[model samples]
Structure formats: structure tokens, C-alpha cells
Target: MELRHLRHFVAVAEEGHITRAAERLGMQQPPLSQRIKAIEDELNVQLFRRKPRGVELTEAGRVFLDRARATLAHYDGAFEATRSAARGEQGRLCIGVLPTTLFHPFVPLIIRAFRTTYPQVSVTLDECMRAEAIDGLRNQQLDIAFLRSAIDEEVDLNAYPLLNEPMVAALPSDHALARSGRDAQSLSLKDLADEQFILYARKLGPSFYEATMAACIRAGFTPRLGQEAPRITSALSLVAVGLGVSLVPACMQNMTMNGVVYRRLKGAVQPKAVLMIGLRRGDTSPVVRNYVSLVRKTAKTFRPSEKEAR
Candidate 1:
């Protein structure tokens, strides 16, 4: 009839005595007996055979006991699942990421750490271009995004800085600089003035585009534009084919293109490339918050200068 009725029935069935069931339930024997009687009357079936000493379950009582236990167990499981989801321990998190962020070692490190901490939470990732990732965050299609550069401050999102590293030149292995056979300690941006330059699309990262152009201008020559690719990795692929040299985030050195070599760039001021995480400013999802907290902790170990580079 009710959960309490099932519970009372179960207690009496297990103890095989109304007195003991009442003691176990912390209730009086009379109330427990009445509740058990009400359940049997509602069902129109005999649940027990009363004996001089105690009682014994009838065939119907055994069957009802099994069903009652199952129902209670099902309710308990549902309750736990709901609580876990609310705690962010078990749920799905959809993340949008720029392709370049995958090249950074810290990206995987943080992801692995988060997985270890919340193994029950399901994580799904989408590798998107800057524009797409931004749109996804704005539309609530993505819980968070890892970006190559910060979005405009006017956007209604919070950007958390993750990594800051200087730009490096990706040169064709057979090119003069790479074949000089010795790694130069550092080279200025002016040195590449005459060489054709491969770059990422301006729309993908306006800040990086401005920084590169400003560095070249400060070095006394505008970069000779050769080709533009949608992603930094694509730009590197172009460099490997000897189309032209490209400047990429230093962490991209981890990306190994067969014919490409990464060389540090030095100048009056070396422009730094930044990796950031973007999330809706009003997001209150516990899983997203947990991930943002982990990113902040990971950023702390990148050295104070890199942390402040943004």
C-alpha cells in the first residue's frame, strides 16, 4: 500500500516476530502489528501464519518480500544517482578546444588529472576553430573551451589564462637556417624579413595576428606574406613543405612534422602567445567549475612570468 507498509512487512518477515520487528523499527509492537495487518487487508491475502512462539511467512508473504526489497533498492539507487550528478561526480561535460591547445603538454596533463579525480564523469571534447568554439560557448552548446587567444573583453564570457609561451619559428629542415647544421641560440624576427611567411588565418586569432605583424614591423620590415592556413598545425605543415616559415607557440615544438624544425626567436621584445579557457560567465555547473579550478592550479606551475604574460 505504502513504503512504510512494505518496510513493516519486510521487518516482520525478516525477524519472524512482530515484537522483534517493532524493536528493530524503533516503534511499538501494537502499531507495527496494525501496519502489517493493514498491508495484508489491502492486498486481500494472508501474509503470515501466527504461531504460539512467533510467526512464519506464508507463500504470498515470501513473494511480496522479494518485490518489496527490489522496489526499495531501486529507489535507493535512483536517489544516489541524483545526488552524484548534483555533486558533479557523475555527469557529462562537453568541452570545445582549439586544435593548437592539444599540442601543449599541459592540456593532456590537466585532462588526465581531471579524469583521475572524477572517473565517473563523462568528458567529451570537440576540436573547433576559434570562431566555432566561441559560438558554441555563447550558445551553451559547449560547457567550456580551450582557446589560443582571449576573446574580446566585451564578450559575455570569462577567459582563464592557461599557458603563455614565446613564439618559435617552424622552418623547413632543408632551409638555410636549419641546414646551417647548428641550432642558433636565438634569432631575431628581422632575420626572416626576406623569407616568405606562413601564418594562421587572421580571424582565428586576431591578437596573435596583431602581435606577429607588430613584431615584424618593429624589426624594420613587414613580413612577406606567402600563405595562410586555418590552424597553426596546418601552417606548420605548410612550412614543412618549404612553402614558408611560420611562427607558432613555443609549446608547439612538441608537434613533430618530419621536415619542420622549431627555433626560438629573440628580438627587442619577443611576442608571447597565450592559451586560454573560455566559459559562459553565468555558468553554475559544478563539473565546469571543477575543471576551471584545476586549470587555475595547473597555471600556477608555469612560472610567474608566464602566468603574468597575458
Candidate 2:
């Protein structure tokens, strides 16, 4: 029998009369009686006993009522859950983030805000390189990513700028400039002319590496490249070991590497560490949209500017 039959049976059982039950259900007495009959017939049992005064429940009717009530409660709960998901109040979101993002002060702030706002929604975060983040977004393996901007135009994704972090120079504590007291003030690229440079791997982003080289060229002489590291942390670690000085995002300053000191760089050509929120081109999940919005808001509150860092 259909849900309507169970509902009608329940109404009749509660009202103790078909005529009154039909009035309560906004229907005719005959149809309500027929629905109850259909349910009993399907179950092959009598669900009620009729007397001149009113109707009473049979032993079978008492057991069936409990089952019907439970079924209705289950349906109500399921409907509520589906509606919550549709409204972005519940669901799972997987986000891929660049390793450098963890160094940014605002990343954790945004995560905390998102967790508080959507307590019921499950969030999973993965630290990935820029290329891997791009691949994850394209393959639908991640709902969104926080990464550097300047993505390829051909990728099927949408990116919104989250923050712009200026680059800083990480120097060895005992280096000449560090000894001369010149490291405390904002430094021009010219100051690094005689210093050996540690470079980020070319594979990370050729354009970014090239930008660093260009900045050095504009300063007067090409920086002497002494070593290459695959990630920002590795580059800083090399600097800490007195391998060579390197220019890195200002956010890296938050990391305390022994013997490594961060100095502000001077020049009109500030290489920015941009944070972007990326999603598949056609993603329509409400949860993803809400998360993106929250990220944008958080970014606005704590976003760094080139002049501010300088």
C-alpha cells in the first residue's frame, strides 16, 4: 500500500471514525475508508473493530501503527537531510592547497571560520604543489584549491585572488650585509649583486623563476645561482646552512629557521606571492560556493599589500 494508505489508516485510528478522520485529512469519508481498507487488504489482516459508538484497534493494528509511525519519521528525517545538503548546510568539501599557503597567516584563520560556520559539513585539506592542485581541480578530485595565481588559461577552472604576499630576502646571519647592519633596512636588489643566490626549482613555475632573474638583472648584475631547491622550505633550509641567500614570499618569515634572517626588498618590481581560490569551471555545489565566499571574506580581512610589507 502507498504512504497515503498508511496516513489514512493512522488518521482513522486516531480519530476513531472514518467520517471524522476524512474531515481532519481534508477528504471525503468514502475515500478515507477505502484507503484504510486497501492497506488492510494488502497486509491480509484486520486492522480495526467497528462498534456503534466508534472504532477500536485490533492486535495487528497496534503493531502496524508502530511500524507506520517509524516509517514516517524516517522519511521526515531523510527529507530534512536532503534539504540541508541542498542549502549548503551539510556535505563534504575536499580542498587542495599549495605548501606555501600554510605559511600565510590568513590560511588558518579562514579554515577556522569555515569550520565554525559549517560545523556539520566535513572538510578535508591536502597540501599539494601548484601543478598537482591544478590537476586535482581538473580531475574533480578536489572541490577547490588555494594556490598561486597565474594558472594556465587553458585549464577548466575559475580562480579568485585571495591574497598578495610580497617577496623578501632570506639571508645568512653572518653574511657581509648582515654584519654591516644594512640587513635591518629595506634593501635594493643592487645590494645583492655580489651575493650568491639560491633559486627555486625551474619546474615549480618557470615564469616565477624568470621573474626573480629579471628583478636581479634590473638591479645591475645577474645573481650568481649557487643551488636550486624544489620547495620554499628547502630553499630556506639551504639559506639557513649558509649555502646562499634567496628571495622568498614574505609569509616564509613566519617560519623560524636557525641562522636565516628575512629582510624586506626594495624595487618597483615586487614579485608577489599570490593566493587564489580555484574551482572547476562548472561546479554548482552550494557548499563549494559558500566555502569560496568565506575564503574571499577571510582574504579581504587579512590580505597583505606590497607597500605594507615594504
Q: Who wins the TM-score comparison? A: 1
lDDT of each: 0.83, 0.82
Tell me the tens digit of each residue's lDDT in model 2 across 1-310.
Answer: 7777778888888898888999999999878777787788888999999879768899999999899988887888999999999989899999897877887777777888988999999999999987888899888899989877666684678888877778888899877766655547568778888888988887874544776798888777888998888888898889989999988878887788888987887776566667788898878999998999888877677845443366
lDDT of 1 by residue, 1-310 (tens): 7787788888999999999999999999999888888888999999999999899999998998899999988988899989988888888889897887877777778888999999998999899988898889888899989887777673688887777778877889888777664555457777788999988889877766777888888888989898888778788889999999988887777677899987778657687788889999978898998889988898888553342222
Q: What overall lDDT, based on C-alpha atoms, would model 2 receive against the true structure?
A: 0.82
Please give the distance, in angstroms, between residue 176's alpha carbon in candidate 2 and its true position after superposition: 4.5
For model 2, give the RMSD to the true fold.
3.6
Off by over 4 Å in 2: 11-24, 28-30, 46-59, 88-90, 176-186, 218-220, 266-269, 303-310
Task: Provide the RMSD of all predictions against the true structure, rounded to 1 decimal.
Answer: 3.4, 3.6
Model 1's number of clashes is 0
